[model samples]
Target: MSENTINAVTRRHWVLIACMLSMFMAAIEVTIVATAMPTIITELGGFSQFGWVFSIYLLTQAVTVPIYGRLADMWGRKRVFFIGAGLFLLGSILCGFASSMGWLILFRAFQGLGAGAIMPLTSTIIADVYPPKERAGVQGWLSSVWGVAAIVGPLTGAWLVQHFNWALVFWVNVPIGIISMLLLVRFFPESREKTDRRINFTGSCWLMLTVTALLTALLQAESLGYWTLVLSAVALLAGWGLLRHERYSGEPLFPLAIWRTRTLLAGNVGNLLIGAAMMGISAFLPTWIQGVSGGTPLQAGSALAMMSIGWPLASTLSGRLMQHTSYRFTAQLGSLLLIAGTAMLLILHRESPVWYAGLSAFVIGTGMGMTSTTFLIAVQNTAQFEIRGICTASVMFSRMLGSALGTALMGAVLNYNLMLRLPQYSDPVQQVMSPAGREQLKPANLDLMLTEIAHSLHWVFVVSLIIAFGSLLMSRLVPVQKPH
Candidate 1:
């Protein structure tokens, strides 16, 4: 490997620092808000609208990632990065001033529009700056930023809530974001030949509408009941229109080349499946640990922590493996490990020790690290520099879509199973799944309810295991050798 490809130049290292800061800022937002959610709701006095704060951010972020990415390719990464950072900072400042939940949600949506650009561009810039082999390790560094944020965000939010106003949580991002923007503007040089492509405004609108419809329907499925079906239909039709428009448009929002790349297609499918499984683990594992095994909340958290540790370690190692082996083999190893870890969960019981869960979590995390890193590096390598941003954004979008779909499906399964098991007390059974709900039930019925919930969780794990194996199958279809 050439020195320029294998090692970062001083300039590249500085760029990576800026990327890391931008990444950390976005990563922290994902979790930090959760810690202050209750306090915000209490202060804002819109209990019914509280969930919108998170939903709006995720929805806008997911919808706009590709748009920002394509614009980055057309305009330039530096300009795109600056715009994203500025918007994110402005939204954060506005959020600090929010007097009600409605205002907070609106500000969050604005923040998410900025985040859409920040995430994909972070990887795209790294790809531009680093070679394929080196990209894996650098990607690991970025992956670790999320892990670190997961650990620190809640604590930081808690500290801010206790010591200062909750607004400080949003205000904290302003300085970091500004610093990142300055570093990018000062240090990172734009080298790509900018594409003089016509902006696909119609395609962008249809794509956004489709995603909004689908995400909103999925999120509001329980509340909206039959109306969800109508929204889903609208989403399907809008998505079809978007695809048709992209197929004929001179400058498409979603490039047709994405559909033609075999490896990219397979890798994205695997990402979607893995993202779904990961969400299942995140959403339901705590309930299983505390309710089924009688473990403390701290113990449940430790299991997740183990997964975090395992992910970055395996991610860093995957980069080294790419130097010796093909991307396909490394990613396949990750898929196999994921299946193994999830398979372990099938055997878990009320009597299974906490270490068993922790070990399983760690192994699965390792698989995710390897698989995600391999896909990102491989896909970016396959695309030309001009379209790299969009390709990278596609992968991220797939993961987010997977998480939303997976959570919804798994939730349905959990609810259905719980309902079947306790047909008589339908209302109380679902509520009892929560810790506070468990406490509300009579002592004599607690074990019975826990057992029923445990059984339902078993089905959830079964769904995750199936998804992991599907990911493995998709990984097999990925091209073993990197494309020239």
Candidate 2:
């Protein structure tokens, strides 16, 4: 090979490596913290504040993503991407040193501020470098980052906690993030473009407040008591104000025209439903398997892993489909697969084998893979470069928003059914079922409580199946785009 050709290949390889590492840092945090939560709470001793560690990161990321997306379009990709990586690294360092849960949550929010830029910007950068047709395949590979993270994060977290301190979980991101940032600086290139410099700070504030209030309310619905209602109201009012502001602002944070196209409209709706259903399943599937099906934790994890496996495989396959077929068909095919998987879920019983759950998960994952990959590629194809970043960010934000809301809704369903059906034993049953509370259960009532827990989880799966079907219905509305 010629030296110039080898150089080009090397640059592309480094870019891909940087993208994967950056994406992994952002994605793995979502699950890696799960294994360390108990350890964190034990050492920090603010049980009530533990959820904030995760919640704050998600809330900050969701609200700020669009702002970063808009900024990326205005200032160019390199600066925004670097800023995000820097903030993320800084946050990781701070989190590692946090003296309390509150401090850790604050640091995590900082990390999320950086992450807001990372997720959308990574896709945008990929879009910038690759041709339109090749983007689908590239994105398919990128989508696997989440799957790999899902499988490895918990184990990595567990190992770190076992061998060292829980603080290492946060600290670990520092080196990887630094490497990613450095790679971008040394190798990544972008044209310095002149564009509209005016930023709608007011609109951004409104968005941040709106998303924070909304996500917090959803996340805390079961525990927030009357405060949940208050936050929900604030969210609604803020959302209304945000809409009006964005509609009138000189430089709207999220362009209103993107929502006008049938392709974007349908894609957004489908993405939201897909994200919602997927999140709901991930959050509750393990509980259902273990509590209802008498499966071991390993079995429960394997069931979830099946979905992870299916997602990337389908994602990779959809790109080839996009080469010869319409986006609508691939999307619909995915939706149907998901619906079929959910249907499988509906029939699961206490006697079902663990592999049965895994099989259902695999099918749903396959559908998710195809559906998400198709919508992203379709949305990008539908817009010009001027608004591509915003459009891309908007799609991502929708999915995150959906996942947050879906999780809350599913949790409510699970808890409500448990309370309603086993009123006499609800409180004690919930307590004993918790990891720390398992040993506290009265020896005589243990069997009865387990049975009740299983029954309640069955109802939760039923609710999840209904929600999954909703995604299938939404997928039908997505307009098919012929491959260019």
Candidate 3:
């Protein structure tokens, strides 16, 4: 190759690496908080509102992803990315100093808003720099970073919490975010689709309102029975209005033309289901370890690490294997493994061995890694270069929506089961229910109730199995193709 060509390739690779690292940092930040949540909640004294810390972040992130994606198509990727990184850093710093759970939740929303831009742009930038044939392997490398982050985030969080304070968990992101912002500004190329498109403020408002309502309904369904129904109806109406606006508006939030492709639609559906399952598992695993297996915070962190290990390993191997096989087959195989892994979760019980649970996580992670990266590759390959950003963003939005809904639903299920079972336990047994709650439930009659909490999680596992099967079914819609 010519010297100039080699220079271009080197620059592209460096930019890709920087963007991937940023994405990894954001992904890890979400999960790393899990290991330290118990400590944080105890300190902040807001166990009743613990779920909001995660849900609010997820909700804001989900709403902003598509908006950023659309904006990147209009303004530029580098500008949007840097703005996002700065916002993330600012939020992280504020989060570290939060004196109350409410403030922490608010700051986390800012963090999610910034994180909204990271993942979609990472994929879009990759597509911008690489040709179709070479993109799959590169995407796999990016996928592996998530695994790395998953493993590192929790272990690091646990250490910080043990040696320093829980606030360090959020503070640690400051340096990483600053470094990523500097690298992106220095190395990333500015890319945008030139257009005279005007911003659709009304359409954007409608879209936001629609999603906010829908997410609120889903998240608060169990808590506010009447409000759930009211919000659901309003959301449906607003969603219909948004669709109509998009269909007719000159510059829509998401171009209606992209939805015409079957690949994009199918990939997004599968991603939504997969996202729900993935987040549900991620959120619950640590809780299960601490509550059921009676593991320490560090041990719980380590068990979750198995998932990190399994995903990246499979992603790296799948990258090489994709060179010899088709995306469809790879995705199918991955989805099947996910189904099998989730099915195996049904065997997990309070009395089950810890290794067995870890094994299940590894299997599930591997399957997720294979299917997610492959689907991303498939969708990118199917779309035109100019519209790739929006297409990729759409898939990510679906995943976020799934994650938000899943976290909310799973939280409700866990709480419901706990409440139902808690009343039956004697004080002594209930005292062992949760490390955070142990002191409050010290009555002697709660012992039997504590044991029953273990069985209630079985219902959660059954729900997860249903979600995994849904993902499998959606995977079949992906058309099979041989390696080029």
Q: After superposition, how far is residue 274 of candidate 3 from its true place, in Å?
A: 0.3
Candidate 3 residues lying further than 4 Å off, grouped into runs, are 1-9, 34-49, 97-101, 161-168, 220-226, 285-299, 408-432, 435-455, 482-484
Q: Which candidate is the best by lDDT?
A: 1
Best by TM-score: 1
* Between candidates 2 and 3, the TM-score winner: 2
Candidate 2: residue 411 Cα off by (Å): 2.3
219-277: candidate 1 lDDT, tens digit per residue: 77887899999999999999999988988888888777788887788767878898899
Alpha carbon lDDT of each predicted model: 0.84, 0.81, 0.77
* TM-score to native of every candidate shown: 0.94, 0.91, 0.85
- Model 1 pairs whose backbones collide: none
lDDT score of residue 317 within candidate 2: 90
Q: Report the candidate with higher TM-score, 1 versus 2.
A: 1
Residue-by-residue lDDT tens digits, candidate 2, 1-484: 1212222433666777788889999989977888888898989899988778888888888888999888888777778888888898899889989998888999999999988999998887777666677788888888888889988998999999999999899989888988988887777776335664677899989998899999999987767899999999999999999999988887888777677887777667777888788875687778767665555678888899999889988998999898888787888889889888877876776678888989989999999999988988888877777677788899899899989877887777777877776777656444553666666667566666766666676666676677666766766666666656
Worst 10 residues of 2 by lDDT: 1-10
Evaluate residue 168 in candidate 1 and report its C-alpha lDDT on the 0 to 100 scale. Answer: 94
